[model samples]
Target: MSARDWQKSSFSGEGNACLYVSAPDNATIRLRESDEPDTILTTNPTALNALIRNAKAGRLDHLSKG
Candidate 1:
């Protein structure tokens, strides 16, 4: 985790609620927030792509608190 470079989302606004993403290795993607660097969420490429696709299709809009 320390060796790889983490990048922030371009959509992240001028707030502390920033999203960071990186690949820790060849097989896994790591996601974390700017405020909680220690808390990382790891997932495989397949599942991560599925989540992105579902999110883009508005299939997961219902999960929002707003």
Candidate 2:
């Protein structure tokens, strides 16, 4: 799949600084920052699921460090 079709997280705003994620395919998930498409990160479904779960559980709220 082409990166052009990937969707940016709802948290993304007007600025070009944002992260984008593509739907899972072949057990792998794709991630890249809008400002740096050349640097993509791939992760396994299990790990991705865990991260999502943690975020939902508020365990990852530290990401918004004040």
Candidate 3:
């Protein structure tokens, strides 16, 4: 695997919790948090878009409940 150029939102503060995203290729997306750099999550574009859409619509909120 090659090194990915990770990017974070401009609104992200200079803190350890910032989320970073990268495109390893046209078909793959990579995600990582600054506090846990060694752990990365991968998915395809379609799945990622679905996640974002569902998140915005509060469809995934239940998963966060304790």
TM-score on alpha carbons, each prediction: 0.80, 0.67, 0.86
Rank order (by TM-score, best first): 3, 1, 2
lDDT of all predictions: 0.88, 0.86, 0.87
Question: Lowest-lDDT window of 10 residues in candidate 1?
Answer: 1-10
Give the distance in Å from residue 55's predicted Cα in candidate 2 to where it truly belongs: 4.1
Show how many residue pairs clash in every candidate, following the order shown. 0, 0, 0
Candidate 1 C-alpha lDDT tens digits along 1-66 = 662589888999877899999986889999999889999998989999999999999999999957
Question: Candidate 3, residues 1-66: lDDT per residue as tens digits?
Answer: 334588886767997878988996899999888898889999999999999999999999999999
Write out the backbone clash pairs for model 2: none
Best by lDDT: 1
Candidate 2, residues 11-63: lDDT per residue as tens digits? 99978889898866768788999888888899988999899899999998998
Q: Per-residue error at 17 for model 1, in Å?
A: 1.6
**CA shift at 47, candidate 1, in angstroms?**
0.6
Better of 1 and 3 by TM-score: 3
Better of 1 and 2 by TM-score: 1
Q: Supply the TM-score for candidate 3.
A: 0.86
